[model samples]
Target: MAYSYYAYTPSHTAALVFAILFSITNAATVAQWIRYRAWVWLVMVVAGFMESLGYIVRTVSTKNPDKKGLFVAQFCLIVLAPVLMAAACYVIFGRIVYRVVPVESRTTKFLWVPPGFITTIFVTCDIVALLLQLGGAVLVSGTQPTQSNVQQRIQTGKNIALAGLAIQIACFGFFSIIALRFHFISKQFDKRLADKTTDETTEDEKYIMVNETQRKVLKNWRPLLRVINVACILILIRSIYRVCDFALGKSGYLEQHEWPAYVFDAAMMLPTLAIFVYWHPGKYLPYLGFRLPKSRRENL
Candidate 1:
């Protein structure tokens, strides 16, 4: 007989808990974005909103496990939400690079044209991934009633989703290398600044300290970059966990088990967004010349 519902159903209590949490988080992010007028947060806000909706649907699916529509909507929303989160992190790197990495220190002055061109590349990749995964889910959702046919379609969809996630992983890896390069460049600049001011050893030598503001800027830069990078690592780990799940297919341990998905995907994602909620770059980045759009700037 053809399967009537998902092979496994999520726990209603657990889904409800997650749904509430995600809703609260999304609301808080939206409020913060409005207060700060950080329109850049629109991407993350949408992702968070999707997450909340997904978990709500997940809760509904728990009550009616045979509702294929609910299952498909939840699965697709949850799967694509992180793609947006990843794009937000990519933009953060561009903002930090613009502020901290001097034009001369960069490989090419125009490398990140239109301000956040590097971030734009990552966003484009994310959109590609989102489309593939969404297409795959739509295909699987419409599979025939025959058990074998349904399984086959599901597998095919999984494969497509896996391909998209792989591209995202590659983009993230390349972006990491660029971020590390910026770190080294900043260190080199700091060293040069110290050497130039070596003779100004006196405690009262404020004026003698070459580029004091620049050095202070770097100091501020490190903590914010470190926090966002940590968030990036969390998202990367979540993606790898998902890629493994897709590779294992429906019968695999990671795919069959709810706990692993909760731990690796939901738990990891929660804090990744939380970090940005607490440490929004928009509040601090303006001082470093990474100003919001002039139209938004007027409101601030």
Candidate 2:
């Protein structure tokens, strides 16, 4: 039997709609990057581009489902795009630490890793996962569906992809812990600041001097953090879905049904992009080339 690129015919309407949506989001992300020059949103721009292109190729796949090249291209783009988005999330969290947390607290470290290096650590893990998934996607896409050993090759590829996803999940888990820790610590710090007497000369008060505008910006960090946490949960749900989808093999119900992919992956990721555009971090964080207000005591 010839290899079936899709168990059910791909939906042209759905693919085209998603392609357009992602394109719009990508354009918006580019605009945000141009306006703010924040490097983190640039990562989101690339992910959005990949998503748009993937759906475009998927639209083509609806017409030419048996074309291995189209299948491979869409597979690679859609699978790898989220990894980049996840990296953006990591970078955003690091920026939040720098922008909101007091210099005194973060100067030492946050969760055993310096605030500056958070992006480096998580993104390095993301890169490793991306490469692994890419390799697995190629292996799976290249296999001849009718070969006697086809099932075995497919299983090998699935295992590799699963391994990459496992790493991503682990990273998210650890990152969440760090984020929650920071959240609680910041909350306590804020409370202490609120309770301080005007005449008190505590270390925190000395270090936390900021203009009214900067203080307002710092106050709004919680909303951005909540948005990020929501995005993280959606991505985690999608990741878990992918794991189950692959574990069931080619004959699995997920592979046979088209709706599940749209519901679990497409629907989930669309909002992830939309939320960022709506509550863009650039609006809250200082524009590129500007630093958050430095500690007044340090200047003296």
Candidate 3:
């Protein structure tokens, strides 16, 4: 006997709707990237593309629910796409640190990792998680329902996927702590700057003047950090939902009910993309060839 690819019949309407939604956001992000040329956002653009493609594949899967290939394609795309979004988040935070924090204060070093290395560290971890989840998804989707070892294979696959999800959760949790720490430190720095009334300015105070100048061209770093924090929380929530999903197995309540997947995964991820588009880093971060006024440059 063939395995049922889905616990419930996939809904074409729902899939199509999301496909269109993601596509729109993807296009908007692409335009934002082009307009601002913020290359760091490239990962986010890829995530949006994968999201649209995932939903598109899901829409197709509704027509042939028994096709394992279609099932695996949609599953892998949907599951791994968020990893890219997570990677983008890591990069965004790093960029924010570089742009907002004064290098003269040496607070950048206090981040436990340098701003430049933040993307390298977290995104590398995210890749490991992505690969693990991809391998597990393929393994689980490859199994035949009638095979004697089917349950064992499914169990093994779920274990691997769970391991990936666990890593994601840990990474997100640590990343959140780091972000919170940075937020507090930044607040303190801002407060100290405000309290000082000397004509003689500290290097950190000079950096704030430059930041204010940049703010005229780019979105304010403070609000951008808040946007990033919200996006991070959304991704964490989705990751937790995925952990429960794979742990519960195919017959699990979340698996059996399609609504939860939409509510927790699809609905949650849509805003993750949409929020970025609204407060696009490209609009906020200084891009290549962007120059500060000669007066501001001379001040530094």
Cα lDDT of candidate 1 equals: 0.71
> How do the residues 1-300 of candidate 1 rate in per-residue lDDT, one tens digit apiece?
434455566688988998999998888888878776677768899999999999999999888876778888898888889889888877777766655445554444434334446777888988998898788766765465666778878888888888888998888766666665566556655554344444434442211232342222222446556766687787789889989887887678985678887898889888877777777765556432334334221111
For each predicted model, how many residue pairs clash, with residues at least 3 apart or on different chains?
Answer: 0, 0, 0
Measured by TM-score, the strongest candidate is 3
Per-residue C-alpha lDDT of model 3 across residues 87-181, encoded as one tens digit per residue: 98888887666555555554346886655467788988899899899988888876778889999999999999999989888987799878877
The models' CA-based lDDT, in order, is 0.71, 0.77, 0.79
Number of the candidate with higher lDDT, 1 or 2: 2
List candidate 1 segments past 4 Å from native: 1-4, 108-116, 141-148, 189-219, 287-300
Best-matching candidate per lDDT: 3
lDDT of 3: 0.79
The C-alpha TM-scores of every prediction are 0.80, 0.84, 0.86
The C-alpha stretches of model 2 lying farther than 4 A from their native spots are 1-3, 107-114, 191-219, 288-300
Model 2 residue 221 distance off true place after TM-score fit, in angstroms:
1.9
For candidate 2, write residues 100-197 as lDDT tens digits.
55556666355567665788899999999899889888887767767899988999999998899889888876786677667677675655445332
The 10-residue segment of model 1 with minimum total lDDT is: 206-215
